[model samples]
Target: MMRSPANKIPADGEPELPGVPHVHVASVVSALATLDAEKAGLDALAQAMAGPLGAAFDVAVATIHNSHGRVIVTGMGKSGHVARKIAATLASTGTPAHYVHPAEASHGDLGMITSDDVIVALSWSGETVELRDIVEYSRRFDVPLIAFTSNPESALASSASVVLNLPVAQEACPLGLAPTTSTVMQLALGDALAVALLQSRGFTALDFRQLHPGGKLGASLKFVRDVMRKGDAVPVVASGTNMGGALVEMSAKGLGCVGVVDGAGALVGIVTDGDLRRHMAHDLTTRTVDDIMTPAPRTVRPDQLASEALNILNSRKITALLVVDGTVPVGALHIHDLLLTGLA
Candidate 1:
């Protein structure tokens, strides 16, 4: 039997390597062949289902979407691992899901199943003995059962409300003892189902950010409003304010720049440290901000994404951006803000 690198260990009498372990080329080739077979299997399954069960796939999505309760995923052995992953993907993508070991269900966990829940059962042959109790319970309680298997005529398939009969394919294992291609197909199908449901439900990136708020993805989806310095914290000076006053505002606000607003409170220009450097030789107390400020400086909207703001800051080689509502400046965003949020 072939073992993956993760499961491989030294035999009883085999000597351990000192350093820089060598990979087995033949094992790698075998693993590549298994990956190729699974790719083919997925293509074949997609083509087969497109012709016959396309409408059924839509029905399954609708059923899962309309259900008031969570999706209960169940399976045994390797299929159980795939089931757990499928449940996690579904939960993270807006569909509520949980994994229940069928063996545990037969003992007492069957009580967790509710009539409002939908059942997604995984079995390659559709005849795993441990899954019998959960299937029976789902049947008796009138919960919708979605079966993922290779046999259409199997008992599990016969009892299901919707059956996703995966294309028959060989196991990648040379001895046909381990599940490789079959489990890949199951995982791919689970991902497809979750994505279809996500699109059907009109799930937005904002909604996804709310669900996953701990990672780089969360930072990427954060809005400009979430991090920008707003209101009185923003450096501002009237369009007619002297360079002396603008400099004082820039120093007081500590944004390294000051926004110049017109009589209507519309941003007319921005005076950065660069502007101060260029005009320092001039009579600073006599020079008006309009004489040295950059007119129509690059700006971002309060509703824009921080990532986009980062892009602007990068492409323009600027250190800060004024967040505006039309011509009205509402906030200020320094590169430090994005850096603080891990978005830079």
Candidate 2:
């Protein structure tokens, strides 16, 4: 064992300083056991879905699709938290959705719901009192109701057009009163619904980018064309151009590299600073660009995501890449460009 030089225990208990207590191995084991139990509960929920519940999921997806308005997600207590997250997930994934608190719905927030919209009500016990008003309103207005709960016979489930009754499982909480395991089931089921709807609607990343355009995620989704230097800014020289001219172009473009193109205007090779360094002994003024260029250099497409370009640059250990459409060089991207845009 390596001890720090600062360590100096008091000799013969002259004074034992107060210190952080060591964690008990038994407590660690118990915590791990709890996780295992929760995972098993989730697993049971998955298994239960293989039967009639699977059909109910399909029906729910179809109901949401056929609706002309947004999905109004309603719930109470911890279930309300899960409902809000589910609503956000659905909205971001192309299915328009919003959370409406059941208690608030009774106090005129119910007006936010329309007959054209579908209601997704969540209640672990399926008999939450706050949900009664909205459930009754949904029934009265002929609004489709889909329920996610643990009790099929409860009011919420009985009133729903589609009831997804989750399998009962023990809570990870020792007191068996906290919402732990039940909330996990609700969240997982909600995620499944969102993904199913996303796939059904053919939701693409581009559609997602439209909804989320203010973070690293949005930056990662930006296309190469959005950041690449195009036209006269791209450092290019004819294939037979002299290395001195190529170096001049590389410097002028300030990307530390120049692209070599053939007579047909097709990119044939690239000349980087490293290429110049390796050919330093040669007469660069007389050597043709092709004589010292790296042929078939790694290239990115104009439509590729910036993150994809970053991956190419990082994996190749290079600073710049030529953006091409097939064999023709259209643009160039330097690592600094990505850094400037917060995409790196």
Candidate 3:
């Protein structure tokens, strides 16, 4: 194929590719049309959910909640892609789920589906030829089958124990043949199902953190104990220590601050670089730590979430928080630690 000159502009105002034909529609115009079609599909889906779909949705949520076994999500072609994502979302949000390919289920993979499991099948037309085997298997084993399709009267819907009849809408494809808006609605409905299940189970962010422990989100969910400086790394001085001694500890620990503890070894205050600047005087080093320390400084517990610690740092405009066990200082958390852990 011959290539057109990079700087050349065609007389029709369209890029002159070697084999592709020119069309009058601008790319942005086509994108807007696709978005409008998908938005219409979602709007239709929302309306259906508020009307006829509500009762069935409640039933579906109840069935899944009652089931002790995992969710087996299966679909064909484009629906299969969406099914995989749905399965992942479900699994990540406290529900156990797996995606089983419709065609693969025919070749001994059907054994993966158990009588106790619920099958979620997706097909826009509800007549995908590849889903027949899985559908038949669900019936033979008496497994509850949930079907997602626009045609409630089709074979798959008729066979399903729960039918999520999606509202019909035009496809985003100009030819009206591709699975654009339809797939978007399917994915949205799948997300809705997963969220409903999550809420029903009272799934929490801490639980979600367990499933996603290798990302920035995981770092944010970490506890203060996991990132705080412990033992000798924490800079501390007795409540009556001279400012010189407190400054020495702060500089030695390099945390920009030093925790001040009373004779009982309980954190009573904190002296920071700002304190030193504010108390600047020829006799500064002669003064006691209590003279310059900020009493009842904002503190955090070791068990508090790192994100919460970050909130304190941001809201109070402070660089460090002393982690305490009751009244005793156990550790110190510096802003740098949060930055290193990707929580800041």
**Full ranking by TM-score:** 3, 2, 1
* Cα lDDT, all candidates: 0.90, 0.90, 0.93
Q: Per-residue lDDT tens digits of candidate 1, residues 193-278?
A: 99999998899888898898776778888999999998899999998888888888899999899999999999999999888887
Count: clashes, candidate 2 = 0
Q: Which stretches of candidate 3 lie over 4 Å from their true place?
A: 1-25
Which candidate should be chosen as best, given lDDT against the real structure?
Answer: 3
TM-score of each: 0.87, 0.90, 0.91
| lDDT over C-alpha atoms for residue 67 of model 2 | 89
Model 3 per-residue lDDT tens digits across residues 1-344:
56566533446655444444444334555777899999999999999999989789999989999999999999999999999999999999999999999999999999999998999999999999999999999999999999999999999999999999999999999899999999999999999999999999999988998998877889988999999999999899997899888888988999899999988999899998899899999999999999999998899999999999999999999898899999999999999999999877
What value does the lDDT take at residue 228 in candidate 3? 96
Best by TM-score: 3
lDDT score for candidate 2 against the true structure: 0.90
lDDT over C-alpha atoms for residue 22 of model 3: 45
Cα lDDT tens digits for candidate 2, 117-164:
999999999999999999999999999999999999999999999999
Residue 306 lDDT in candidate 2: 92
- lDDT score at residue 242, model 1, on the 0-100 scale: 81
Cα miss at 149, model 3 (Å)? Answer: 0.5
lDDT for position 262 in model 2: 94
